[model samples]
Target: MSPILLTVNAGKSAAVARTDAPSGLTGIDKRPVDGEVAVSAPGPRGVGGSGLAGDSIADLRHHGGDDQAVYTYAREDLDHWAAELGHPLENGVFGENLTTEGIDVNDTRVGERWRVGDELLLEATSPRIPCATFADWIGERRWVKRFAEAARPGAYFRVLRPGTIRAGDRIEVVHRPTHEVSVAFAFRAQLGERSLRPRVLAAGPALHSELYRNATAWAENA
Candidate 1:
């Protein structure tokens, strides 16, 4: 099936936080918005295109930046979760800026580039790391471990060209790096899975700097 955007979501303020969660602050509480949302590159240490014009990033240290400018989750994956959890899963519930359909997000290579709409260009950078905020947001026990075991952690993208994107926008894979390091591979490597760590090298400089360094170190030790 052709990849199409199912929803465009953004958070105007700090995502709803829970005192019970490990991290009290989070920006995962995104909601779908109507019409077109502007997509643009962010300034240094700034929020990127997916963040929307008035969106907020509560924790700058770990989330929001050029490398993780846009977050995408697959509708197919959400469907799986919905069946497992016995509830309807809505777009943006996973904290993704784009809810996409017909895309194998986990299988996408680390350096894949996507053309959304007519002008926006985005590059896949890394897989999202399940955080305490995510666990609480989903209200699942052992959520992080479960999410990792599922190996369906979606991808984060870096904005290449700025434009506007919305629900129903066409998504095309414009490029795919030769590297065998898919988002799932990178996610496993980030979890200290030595066997998969070497795949990170295939991603070359396309990997996030910190992740690239950590993966390189692990591969060297291996």
Candidate 2:
């Protein structure tokens, strides 16, 4: 299958009664939009939020930044989860800004570059670490544990060149880093695989800053 941007999702902040969101509101309910959505580096975490203009990021401390300006998930992974959970999973249901097809998002190497449509250039940076907000939103027992064990956290991207993206945009892998550290590998390393920490660190400056710091500490202390 040809890789494509299947949908662009943006969310509005809304109250969710039982969520772990500190503000009692969450932006996990992203919905697909037909129109173009602006994409850019969102400055920094806790200060800058979602890169998508219309997207709402409730937990600024955890969600958005230049390194994680955009969250992407593969439709194939979603289908896997849907089948495992015995429920239909729709595009954007995982709170990802971009729903992609024909791309192995988890296997995408850190520092890989993807050209969306024509102008938007995105660099793969990190993997989404499931949290309480995500677990609460999903409402599945031990959802976090399950998701982590599966090691298919999808991929986060930093906007290298700001532009507009829309549903049905073609996605082309413009570059792939020489390193073997992929999003899934980094995710597993972060989840306590001490042996993989060195490999994850080898991805160098392309890695998310926090992950780099943790890997550095782990290597030093090991």
Candidate 3:
């Protein structure tokens, strides 16, 4: 697996990001790591927090999964964006604590689970799509909408048991779901796939409740 950069932040600029913070990512393996995270996410920009409230990574990541990590990404994903879009997706590209390689993060489904170590169980909960904040940061609105259209939506896993996660941990997909709820399908439903909403909602409450809440609301109004 390709080695990716790792970073940790006790607090950020609250305005900027780097510059006035201690880079916890470097001392990870006791080496001057290659790719330092491009940015750091704490309270709002976290994977689950919705950028609204809370201070912990757990508060940020959806389903209240792990406290220390809110978002994670593959170093390759960052490289791909940098090469294609002329900008790199650094600092755990979606606010993930553990940036990995060789793991199919986008191919996960709600209720799906994986075992990372002796006690860590990461389960696929929901898709973490672009939000308004992402648009503001990237300086484009289409990536968010386009991402929803492209369908390779990234999954958010709830940490079942606590365990120490390092930079080079191999995250294997132990349980794959039998559903076909791709990002495209999610967008399709968000656009008009009303019929399938209820079923998707029924499968995983923790995963789909947000979307499920909307689905039911739409269903009642319809």
- Whole-model lDDT values for every prediction: 0.83, 0.92, 0.46
Clashes of each: 0, 0, 10
TM-score of model number 2: 0.97
Candidate 3 contains a number of clashing pairs equal to: 10
lDDT of 3 by residue, 8-42 (tens): 21122132221112321111111112332222112
Q: Which ten residues in a row have the lowest lDDT in candidate 1?
A: 43-52
| TM-score, prediction 1 | 0.92
Give me the candidate number with maximum lDDT: 2
Worst 10 residues of 3 by lDDT: 24-33
Model 1 agreement with the true structure over 146-200: per-residue lDDT tens digits: 9999999999888888888889999999999877899999998888677887668
lDDT of 3 at 217: 66
Model 2 CA deviation exceeding 4 Å by range? 18-20
- Please identify which of the two predictions, 2 or 3, would achieve the higher lDDT against the true structure: 2
